[model samples]
Target chain A: MIPAAFEYTRARSLADALKAAGTRGTKVIAGGQSLVPLLRFRLAQPSVVVDIGHLPQLQGIKRAKQGTVIGAATTYRDLLDSKLLHNTHPIIAETTAGIGDRQVRNRGTIGGGLAHADPASDMPAVVLALDAVLTLQSRRGKRSVPARKFFKGPFATAMKKDELLTEILLPFLPQGAGTAYESFEQAASGYALVGVAAVVAVSGGAVTHAAVGITGLADTPFFAASAAKLIGRTPNKEILRAAAAAAVEGVSANEDIHASAEYRLHLARVAVRKALTTAAGRAG
Target chain B: MTQTITLNVNGQALKAQAEPRTLLVHMLRDELNLTGTQVGCDTSQCGACTVLLDGRAVKSCSVLAVQAEGHKITTIEGLARDGTLHPVQQAFWEKHGLQCGFCTPGFVMTTVELLRDNPDPTEDEIRHALEGNVCRCTGYQNIVAAVRSAASALRGSRRPGAAVSGG
Candidate 1:
């Protein structure tokens, strides 16, 4: 399969990438795991592809007192190799490991995954639950976009054409907080049919805070505020099950060839229940 | 637009003229005539186009040649040296890991990375590592055995600093 002809420009630095993107009909290429496939299928025909895969400024994992900042270009392989991620935010490592196999993960980047906003991608739900912040920059200036508002819909984001997502800032969990990501993968495509990411903060035997993020069940990955009703209550099995059931309270399930809306709703409940239980257990 | 891109494949530098949209798999196979890497699925689902890009396995079909300009690439042809087969190739040959030999190169390259990362992977790990590569034949039993055997052999006979070519 041949992709549509386009001009390719490699950006040696962040400034160069932003400048290239400012041109009309230009798209930033990172990792190329998602965009290249789209290009091959003619689903996306950007006249100019700004390659930012080699930018050094956007290629490391750094943790400060505020939170962990992951360079947008950091590949899944880099995340897996980070001791800080494994120890501090192990859910990121666990979720990334479940993405497309070794080859895809080797070339896929966190920023690309989040920016692509694939409903079935593992990172969106996890990042949403983490309340991560995305840093967008351009030749004009820079601004921060919260994960909650970053994703507009499937394959759509709040980012502008001239801007580039340069970093993702994920806040560190408070003490007694634990997070887990669970997914039910569709065997053939290796994508999550239903995935849930839960963050539970327990204090003095009570659930102080609970955040539930769900994917592959709607037009976009979303937080389940209804599920967080467990706050100020003991998160027992029954309560956790109720929270899981409330996960898709106002959202409509996505129907596809692999699953019906009813079936996806069912799987969402199961995944949420499992994720919350595991997260609560880890919290203790 | 056509561009002359230089690729370091199998420890040798080769130059080819390719359009900005040219995939690395096409450059390796069509331009350089290194046909060991196959393209079973151009959409990146199948691992037949898998190769090492800077010491890691990536689907060549999914990466544009322009993106890989300055990176080191290692394909199946880069494994052997001086008429001696790589330990992985030897294991596959002895274990009948392949039935048609079409998917052999991809499996070999993927296994090279799996073993390098985890020298002694269990049966489940081997299966997980091979999730990207699809083999319609062999049911993957022999392929797992071949990877296990190759891991054992490499641990015993591998020469110091003799890494896979271009890796």
Candidate 2:
């Protein structure tokens, strides 16, 4: 099926993009990987397709004092090829490499992915684990929304209609920290059935701090706060299992053709447990 | 509603007036006559519509003509430069990477970008990277060979002249 007809506006720069996407009925098109396909399926219909792929300011990786800032428009292919992010945030780079495939990754942008806010997306869980901040820009102004507060619901984001996601500010994990992500991907859609991201900081064998994030099982990406509460002191086998269980507590898994809600919840528990183990082992 | 857009296909800039709803594949085949980029499924699931959108591979069927405005694109037609097959095209031909040949150009283009990003990729990495581009033929035995060979050729060409791979 073809996407419905729409007017096209190629934004020359950030200002032009903002003007073109001034709220109502305007859909910003960066990497049409998700949006265009949805359009073809009749999932979304927008009157204006604001093409921002040509905008220069929206692409590339940048280094900052706090951490690294990956431009929202930067493709997963860019992350895969980046030597800098590979060295520092290998989890980000590695997880991104597993996104879809060469062509999809090349065309899909991190910002577009986050803005699109697919519950099963690989980056959101990682960003939440990293405590990353998403910077949104609109004609009115710009605002930084922390990752934890970004998701409002499934396919729902904190972004206003007029705002465009421009930058993802990733905080550097403390030295000697370990981060990892594991996903159970649905073969057909390439979206995760259950995904987990664990970031751990180990200080002299005592877990100093940790963040456990889970996606796909819940309507929104969750921090697994209850599980994180069990890590700060000292994590043992029993605690890890208990935390994994807690990670799925109250999670409302999405059920459709790919997986049942109960099966997704089960995968969430397994994924979290495995991710926690992987993160712990990596840190050690 | 329809609109006109100029596209730079394989270094040759051409102008076409297509419906804003018309896909990049139709514009390439019907308007410009570069029918090499196949449309296997019409759905984005199949990568037969894959083409280089400014040096990166994307499903042409996933993008509209207007969406590709002011950007450079390379189709299967452009794979042969001045009557010489590109390294990727050559590798696919020599390695028997295709049987039906419906998915050849898409696989070739995707592999071109893959090796461009990673000169030498492991078999598992190659398999993972090619997930978006599907080829029913050869069961991927020859596709992997094609990518590995193309990688060596790409490296040889870029580094002030060097020897070819599997020579």
Candidate 3:
């Protein structure tokens, strides 16, 4: 499974990486979990591969003004080991733990995953629900993209080929908020057949903030606007069920050998219901 | 184009020339002549190419040889010392953990990490830890038993006055 021959640049710094990335036909390689597979399969034949996995600037989880700033290159294993992430956004850790397996987690990066924008990947829905912001860097300049606007389609993103995703900014959840991610995974690949992330903030026994993100049910992971229906309403079983149903309303499920479109929608509804219930229970 | 990359394998600093596209598994088996690591599923789904990268288990097939430049890589061949099988290897041998023996290296390497992180793991924990490695034989029962045996043996050796068995 050798990849096609390509020039490799081991970038020593952020500037070096950005410079290399700006070159035509250059592909950034971080962690190389997803990109390596694509390279091996000949699905992507970049003339140059810029290795940025070891760049010191693109590492670590830090406390920020609004919430937490997680380096895009931070691995899932590192995320699991972070007490700050566990305390501030436990759902990130919880969802990451279920991605692929131990070996994959050791090498997969959040930035790589988000930039790859695999519709079946778990983190897109998570960041969407968390309302995370992504910082993109390039030789030209820097810009920020909210997670909601990041995914354009399967294996596509708002990022330009010359830009690199540097940091993911997870905004602090509202005071009374709790977040949870739920998924029905394909048995073999562990990719989500249907995944949902819910952030519920309850205030005075009423739902104040409700955001739902869904994946594996369409061409791209999306913020389910129908979740707004729960706003200002008491989050009882009936209300939660209705909101879950509405979350998948108008969504066109993707069909494949793994599941039929109808079945995928069914799983999406079930997952939404479970995620919302669990998140509401954990809400302060 | 080939690049010379130096890697620390089994406490030895070795150098090999490989293309940027060369996978670490190929470099280990072909260039270094360490064939213990198998490539069951080249797509990284199967852990047949599992190896320790700086004391953590990672699928070598998924890692580029160039990416392993500064990391310490420990393969199944590195487990034994002076012809004596490592405890985890010995446990698998004694417990008949392997039937076909094709997936042994990966399972053994993965267990090396599992036991290192957790000296005493429940059956479910062992099963979950080795989820990446797949064994077609023994129904995973003997494999689980082998990990349990190795864990206890390693724990016992750590106690005071216990015979210091080589890792």
Question: Could you give candidate 3's per-residue lDDT for residues A165-223 as a string of tens digits?
Answer: 99999999999898899999999889999999999999999999999999889989999
Q: Which candidate, 1 or 2, would have the higher TM-score against the true structure?
A: 1
Off by over 4 Å in 1: B158-167
Ten-residue region with minimum lDDT total, candidate 2 chain A: A227-236
Across A1-284, the per-residue lDDT of candidate 2 in tens digits comes to 87787887778789988877686888888888888888888788988888887578998887899889888888887888888798778888768877877778877888888888888888889988888999999999999999999988888999888888999988888767788899999887678888889987777777776887777877788777775575566667777788888878876678988889999988888888888777877875
- Report, in order, each candidate's fnat: 0.86, 0.90, 0.82
Better by lDDT, candidate 3 or 1:
3
Worst lDDT 10-window in candidate 3 chain A: A1-10
> For each candidate, how many residue pairs have backbone atoms clashing (under 3 Å)?
0, 0, 0
Q: Is 1 or 3 the stronger prediction by DockQ? A: 1
Q: Give lDDT tens digits, candidate 1, residues B1-167.
A: 89999878898887889999999999999999999999897668889999999879999999999988978899998998888888999999999999998888999999999999998999999998898999988899999999999999887765677564322
Evaluate model 1: give its lDDT: 0.89
**Per-model C-alpha lDDT, please?**
0.89, 0.82, 0.91
Candidate rank order under lDDT: 3, 1, 2
Structural similarity to truth (TM-score) of each candidate: 0.97, 0.92, 0.98
**Chain B, TM-score, each prediction?**
0.93, 0.92, 0.96
Model 2 per-residue lDDT tens digits across residues B109-137: 88877787688899987888788888876
Error of 2 at B113 (Å): 2.2
Residue pairs in candidate 2 whose N, alpha carbon or C atoms collide under 3 angstroms = none
Off by over 4 Å in 2: B81-84, B149-167
